[model samples]
Target: MRGAIAAMVLTFLAGSAAAQDLQARLNDYPTEARADYVFGCMAVNGQGRDVLRKCSCSIDVIASLLPYEKYVEAETVLSMQQVGGERMSIFRTAAPAKALVADLRRAQAEAEILCF
Candidate 1:
């Protein structure tokens, strides 16, 4: 009986650790960043309550698919690409920058399919 009880306790502890790891991964995206994504999404989609829910879902999908650091890198590359100057041309033409943006776009596409 004692051996069975010990096995059950070990199983419970393992499950708890797994849950904590999952929670940490899910929370990698900061609240402000998530809010920014949802607000931008809502602006393009709509301002209704249902749109809010969808936008929130979209960001959650994105957060699940892409790490925050990669997301930020892609965002920076995109923002830089928007600038009209020789100095900013690298953002438009560089292979690394393109790859970063491509990863972000793929994540967004996945999010769109799943959320909307």
Candidate 2:
């Protein structure tokens, strides 16, 4: 019984994250979110001059945060940043927070509903 209840809670929470709207999440996204993203990018990409570039996060991250078109744009920006300088771009060119905030808010709302 306890196991089943815990499973349900986890499943419900995941569903709530999926239910969030992209735009709303972006709009409501906190500054710390962006900072964390930047720091994560730096940590993942590393700081240095190399012939090849490495990224901090995976495509799944963008796919999770943005729509297909936005994801494409994000990729383009990342590519450009990589060519120019790794630290100079990445998160700076990531999908807009307004969009993320929409998704977050929606997901949070859904989770709240499921939680009670």
Candidate 3:
């Protein structure tokens, strides 16, 4: 029926809009978040340990899937820094987060876990 078709169309449009919003939010995520995402990926991919190869793969995967903005969100939502076993980082990013991403990628590239 026409009513059914209209309802389906409305649902599809709403879903599309929501998907766009999620993408936008992901893009807007902060550098710290991105780091966190990296940590999470490292944790998951490397047998519950931080493995550089796994981390790199995870970052690459994320970079390929996200637009610049979503990548920023991933970076923001995921970024973190551990100093003397204390984790610290900014949790929100209102800017591009590219600098953070670049810095983080470089740090990750060079990092070796001193403990754990």
Candidate 4:
């Protein structure tokens, strides 16, 4: 029926709009950052063309889960935690810093599950 066809068309349009919105959000993740993540992921997982696909998927999942600003903050805190010194203690011990890294870790874990 025409009514059913119209409903289907509307549903398709809505889905397309949602897909575009999600792509826009994903675009907020910079190309260089995404490439760096994929490269690191591939290095850890093993290098190969197949690894490239998996790593790319991993970054995509991460992009979907996090805004770029939060991702960057989390990465910086985590990196600072690796440096051994009293001055770096804040990054290692602060609750807010820990929470930010935790959020990033959770997003990574989710990405691993979904992509790897």
Name the top TM-score candidate. Answer: 1
Superior by TM-score: candidate 1 or candidate 4: 1
Q: Model 1 clash pairs?
A: none
Decide which is better by lDDT, 1 or 2: 1
Superposed model 2: Cα runs more than 4 Å off = 1-22, 48-116
lDDT of 1 by residue, 7-84 (tens): 999999999999998888877999999999999999999899999998999888888888899999999999989899
**Candidate 2 vs candidate 3: which has greater TM-score?**
3
* TM match of model 2 to true structure: 0.23
Question: Please, what is the TM-score per model?
Answer: 0.87, 0.23, 0.31, 0.81
Location of the lowest summed lDDT over 10 successive residues in candidate 2: 51-60
The regions of model 4 sitting more than 4 angstroms off are: 1-21
lDDT of 4: 0.91
Q: What's model 3's lDDT at 62?
A: 51
Q: Determine which window of 10 residues in candidate 4 has minimal summed lDDT.
A: 58-67
Q: Write the per-residue lDDT of candidate 4 for residues 27-88, one digit (tens) a residue.
A: 89988999999888887999999889989998888888888999999999988989999999
Worst 10 residues of 3 by lDDT: 80-89
Candidates ranked by lDDT = 1, 4, 3, 2
Candidate with the greatest lDDT versus the true structure: 1
